[model samples]
Target: MIVAEVVRSGFVESVHHGIVALTVGKSFGDVDSPFFPRSSNKPLQTVGLLNAGLVPREEADLALMSGSHDGEPFHIERVRAMLAAAGLGPEALRCPADLPLGEAARNAWLRGGGEAEPILMNCSGKHAGMLATCVVNGWPLESYLEVGHPLQKALADAVSRLAGEPIAAFGVDGCGAPIFAISPMGLARAFQRLVEAEPGTPERRVADAMRAHPALVAGTGTEDTVLMTAIPGLLVKKGADGVAAAALPGLGAVALKISDGATRARVPVLLEALRRLGAETPEIPEVVLGGGRPVGEVRAVW
Candidate 1:
């Protein structure tokens, strides 16, 4: 199936086109396709921190561990604090630094004459959290992102188990960490286990933390933070390249992949999924391209 449109307004005022594959019922689209889950796997991989005895039973830390923050000052400070607690520093990170998300940080960076600060990098938090895990586990700090590392192996295994499928492919993520691939259904299943893990398990702790501190889970104005906060019992995460997944503790899970790689379609698809499950929101989410430019709208394409 192909999803597309000819936009006549806003940023997409010209001819706007895209494609989305549709698989309903028992059908699975390209079950073994090599597609990257990107940051969507953070919550599942966070189990490594718990399993390796790095986490000290702090919900906020767990949430931060699974987060892809917006690089706000508070977010940067918390990441630094995590590293400090673990006796590590910014020099320990393997992820490359870049400007933060949103206009505030961008404007700040511009004001600083287009200089890149490690704290302004969005993945700094994830990298810092990984470094802390290494500190607590006594693993070598060098090449922590390597697949050969014990921590990486443990994380891969956890992903395999939770996904209930062997990883079909692998690649490096933007943050210099290994990325795993699984079908959309497999991704959904992984999230299901993460949210429904037995009490006292690392997965459960991760889910609980994310649910409790939704704000900390992402940042001030992120989709994961907003959706999870607005909808109780739901844990949502948005990954790179228009991938997103959400799970309800006892209910089912939903995973979406935008074929054209438009991130704007993600939240709207999530809202549709939620509404279909008998959940309602005060306002329908609007899909905007180029930030506030209405390229297309997300309606029931089914």
Candidate 2:
């Protein structure tokens, strides 16, 4: 489906094709087809961690455990804290080292003469949380990222049970953790369940933590953080490869994947989906500039 359009100089120069799943009316594409949800799976995996006996010293730590955090200074501090609390170190992380995920942080890192390190990876928070779970269970921290590991198995079960659908496939994520494939519809269903689950349940704990610490879940000025912060009781998570999922406590839920993997199209389409279910969303700009002036914009075409 052509879900969004890019205009430049008052012309429709391009369009974004994608699949969208909504809890309300008609879906835009093949919602039944399976695809990797990427970091959007973090919250589900966090629930699995809690179920596996992982406990954080502070409830806010759960937000980082389920976050795809920008590699900001605060983010680094928290990841290190999580690891130190588990009697581990940055060496325990298996995710590839990378520059900070946000442009401002990346620039600051370069100015500070910093090199890429595992602790600086955007997913290190999650990897650190995984290590903490292993410590709690005396599981082999070295093999923690293996798909066959007990932790991963429990995560798979959690994802399956929450989605009310069996995992269609399994693969390694960009963060080196096990990623499960499920339908877009299933992803939406899983997010809805998280928001609606009773308080103190593992599911609700994940939702509440993310909602309460939106900045930890992403970073300052990011989409997920902005959405969750601006709209009370809303949950949002974006994944690599153009996948994003969101849910309102009572309104509805949506999941989408842009076929061309364009992140720019995500917010417009997501807002459009939410509007279809009668959500009031902040107006995030998607302007196209030409010769240092605004010329056109990206808008959801549905």
Candidate 3:
């Protein structure tokens, strides 16, 4: 297990546990064990959207579909337009709505006395995409969140194929949507295919969209977007409760799940994973305090 300690106000306040490391053309510990992917399943779900012809073939909104956005006004507006395009409304969204994560955006909304709209929810784009799929495939808008739904079944099959494993479990997401599980290695393999997928394929389209529109993929500033923007050809995705993955085409993939559930350490763990893969970037600076002092370091446990 990997231990990530959090230091605040000059003291250790919390710790997050997880298994994080790089595997080179091979699976790491318990990579075969199935685990629910939560939001990490976004890219796989997009395949259904593509296959059903609900979304444009040349477009890839994979990043937004998988993103936990900051709820910027622009993000909210786009989500709204997406829903409108699908002939749906905010009431149709199963995900909870909230303000953007960015202080500027949140405060601005407050200053304007803007109430939280479903579109402002970070998962709004994902929900909108799902609704669009339902419209395109003539699926019922009601109970679309059900596991047995055709759209969901297709998504599950796509996930299984990408992970090279069968779905092992199911759960409800915070957004009131179905969630599927796969092993750590399975998760890694899914990401591996995402980056290495054949060009023009659904998987590759998602990758390309994410690569092309890093900002729209998340928001003005978010880890997933920042990492992709900072590095070339590095496909990154973040999930709830400290789950994250990074895949480099031909190099391999890395998946992390924090045991203690502290998500604050996600960025550090991801940076460590990148380091293990022998990839370098300037964003991963050592943890430091106000005095320019090294507070605590993020070291790989593998």
Candidate 4:
């Protein structure tokens, strides 16, 4: 699908092609194509942690468990707390060491002469949650990332059950955890289930945590944070490789995958999907800059 076009100074300079699926009684593109949800699957995985007897000391911890945090101070502090509560440490994390994912946070870390570390990885919260779950179940921390491990099996079951579809396949994610491939519509179905599920249910708790702590899900000044903050009762998460999934409590769910994996194209397309679902969102334009000034913008035409 012709999802978005980059217009520079009233001229089309480039375009982004992708698939967008929304449950607003209208559809566009091939919503049935199977793809990895990436970090977008974290919430469902966190639900799996809860089901496996992983009791967090704080409700805010649940937010971190579902987050792809920016490695900001608060984010790192929670991650350490989660691990400490489990008697583990950053050395136990299996995700590759990396700097913060947020622009501002990363800049600050570098300015402080910081180097990449395991706990600083964007996925550390998820990893820490996984480790804590492992401790609760007596599972091996070193093998938690293995697909055959009990933790991974539980996560697979949760993702499948919530998405209402069996996994088409499995692949290693950037964070070293097993990733599931599901249809875009299936992903949308899962997110819808989260928001619409009854209060106190695992799914609803995950949704509530994300909506309540949108900044933890991504970071300050990021699109996911901005969108979730501005749109009431909306839950959104970004996945790597241009994947994103979101649900509005009373509206519907939407999922998309940009064919070229371009980050800039995802939000405009997502905003369009939200608008289709009758969501009132803030004006978030993808300004195209030429010589440090606004030249044009990326517009969604899907």
Q: Model 3 reaches what TM-score against the true structure?
A: 0.89
* Global lDDT of each candidate: 0.72, 0.90, 0.75, 0.89
1 or 4, greater by TM-score = 4
- State the lDDT of candidate 2 residue by residue for 1-302, as single tens digits: 79999999778999999999998766988999899999989998899889999988788888988888888999999999989998888999999989999899999999999999988888898898889999999899889889999989988999999888999999999878889999999999999999999999999999999999999999989889998988888888999989999998788789999999999999899988888867888888788888999999999997
Worst 10 residues of 4 by lDDT: 20-29
Better of 1 and 4 by lDDT: 4
Predicted candidate 3 versus true structure: per-residue lDDT over 21-115, tens digit per residue: 35575433455666776777787777666766767423645567757677776677777777777787788887776776667788998899887
Predicted candidate 4 versus true structure: per-residue lDDT over 246-270, tens digit per residue: 9998899999999999999999999
As for candidate 1, its clashing pairs are none
Q: Give the true-structure RMSD of model 2.
A: 1.0
Indicate the TM-score of model 1: 0.87
Q: Order the candidates by lDDT, highest first — what do you get?
A: 2, 4, 3, 1
Off by over 4 Å in 4: none
Residue 198, model 1, lDDT: 91
